[model samples]
Target: MSERIKKELALYKLREIEIDDMKLKVEELKIGEQLGAMNYEEKVQSSMNCKNNDYVMNEIETLEKRIRFNEIANKRIDNALKRLDIDEAEIVRRVFIEKKSITLTAQELFKSRKSIKKSIDRAFEKLKLA
Candidate 1:
């Protein structure tokens, strides 16, 4: 692989790792939020004046951190794509980031699905060769 493409691939891989980390963090945040809700319900039911303010604050902080992490990761990917001069970031964003079907992406881009597939393949090949 060309050094340039290798570098881009490495950036892409790093971004993927960050994304996976964010996904896990999101799941954890969801669980924490659910627990916080349940705690609020319990406090209400008991009428003991138990305060879950701290719990709510902690969950909010965690959620904010996760959002920040995701934002940074996204920016990194954007910069990497730009550095590679792939000029196909939109295609990648639609097909991969948006999880759109190949056919849908092709229709949206006004290109044949086969052509889009071929382009994607060539991009990867070039990346590898770089």
Candidate 2:
């Protein structure tokens, strides 16, 4: 595979991880918001709740930015895949987009490991040119 395609695949994988992390953060923030609301009765002594809410809000904003970035990256990947041949696109989708292991993808596609690898390499080459 060409270095450019490798870099793009690596970036797509990293963005997938980032998206998952951002989703988790968003969920945590939502839970925190719920908890903070529940503690509204205790607003007398622990003014710390207000501070915590501010922190949670800041985290939510950061998470939103990450989600938007991930969305854009996903669209780019989709466009790239669309430009590829069907078989090449399937290989790329299985390996990168679906996050499948090579062996697993091979099994699922009823292809030999070597064949799957070759397809992946060809996909990368196509993506590099694209």
Candidate 3:
């Protein structure tokens, strides 16, 4: 369970970074559209039926789907954290989400290293991840 939680935390961090990058890509696509550089479609539909925004939206649709997937994964991680007590959640976050060592977390949280380790063990017992 501990190992699984750690792996999920790592994936959560990765998904978060990916979501941010994909959002930036979407923004760049929009900026390109505004700059009259919209050329996302390889083949044209009827020009009478097609609007300018419609041209690039097809491309943005794929990117938005990827962004939404990562967002949902992050939300699941958030919900799991919400199930924990505040202190348990904080310890888990510092140890896993922040990638901090028990010793470092102890120093930051003003607790002993042994205390931090105990809290981490207790938190791991209660944590559920997907």
Candidate 4:
């Protein structure tokens, strides 16, 4: 690839990694919340000891901020995809926008499951560049 193209690709990949990391962080937060709830139920006071309570509150705040930022980045990617004029945009729309599964989206888009997945990945890369 040309230097410019390579740079764009790198940017796209970085954005994708950011999105994926944010999603993982959200999952971690949910797991933390569940565990916290369980712990609190067993012993509310123990779970909220001064230091632990501060730590947990800080963690939740950070997670919420990360989730919000990720959501904004997701919207930016979506807008970028819309501008790319990619024919598979509808497939993306159904899968990401409508939040459908790969199998169902493949059926809707008349593509094989693997193709659908590749399309999604490429779409992410395509939109990652500013």
Candidate 5:
């Protein structure tokens, strides 16, 4: 179960990158459209631009679908965390969601490293049962 949670966290991070890339592509397409409008051969260039815009629009739609799926997956993770006790949930959130190291989490939470590790281990045990 802990492994599954880790995998899901990794997937969530990858999806975030994918979504950012998609947004960048959309911006690039907009720039391309502006350049196409400035072309001296207006008729031919405009026709090509229209086709390109249609393709870009379709790609954006597909990207949006993937982003929505990822968002749903993240929401499910949040809901699962809610099932854990507050301290356990905080440990899980710091280590997994915030992507912090055990030492960093302990420092941030003002707890000893051993205590943090114990909380994390207990959190995983509860998450497994959950």
Candidate 6:
């Protein structure tokens, strides 16, 4: 995968939270807290159907689309990580998921910095194909 995508893998956990938050917001809108979204008569009549309000429906659709995109990205990264060997996966998790510096990760793994860097490179290369 490209560097952009690899880096996005670092955000996988955050994306999970974001997707849930967005779904909650969409559910709220659907359940008719859409008071201000629909005008007077429309508000009274449309409480039964918020989709009558173009803006609210558009917002819900947008949120759903974003949730889908984040889910797909998370799945892609998860699949790639699963394809890695144990050592490579651990290195990727420490450096990317845990946001450790290479030196710190090397120290924790009890390896030299050069060995850690080489493993990272190899993992990324394999990830691209995965």
User: Local distance difference test, per candidate?
Assistant: 0.62, 0.80, 0.80, 0.63, 0.77, 0.82
Which of the two, 1 or 5, has more lDDT? 5
Report the lDDT tens digits of candidate 1 across residue range 26-70.
677667766656554665664433345455556657766766776
Show model 5 residue runs off by greater than 4 Å: 27-50
Q: After aligning candidate 2 to the native by TM-score, how far in Å is the CA of 81 from where it should be?
A: 0.6
TM-score of each prediction:
0.47, 0.65, 0.79, 0.39, 0.71, 0.68
In candidate 6, which residue ranges exceed 4 Å CA deviation?
11-14, 31-53
Candidate 6, residue 36: the lDDT equals: 50
* Model 2: per-residue Cα lDDT at residue 97: 61
Between candidates 1 and 3, which one is better according to lDDT?
3
Q: Which candidate is the best by lDDT?
A: 6
**Is 1 or 2 the stronger prediction by lDDT?**
2
- Could you tell which candidate, 3 or 6, scores higher by lDDT? 6
Give the winner by TM-score: 3
> Which prediction has more favorable TM-score, 2 or 5?
5
**Model 4, C-alpha of 85: deviation from truth (Å):** 2.7
- In model 3, how large is the Cα lDDT of residue 8? 85
| Candidate 6 per-residue lDDT over residues 16-124, each given as its tens digit | 8999999999998888754455556775564554445766779899999999999998887778888888888898888887789999999998999999989989988
What's the number of clashes in each of the models?
A: 3, 0, 0, 0, 0, 1
Q: What lDDT is obtained when candidate 3 is compared to the true structure?
A: 0.80
Worst 10 residues of 6 by lDDT: 43-52
When summed lDDT is taken over every stretch of 10 residues in candidate 2, the lowest stretch is 38-47
Error of 5 at 86 (Å): 2.2
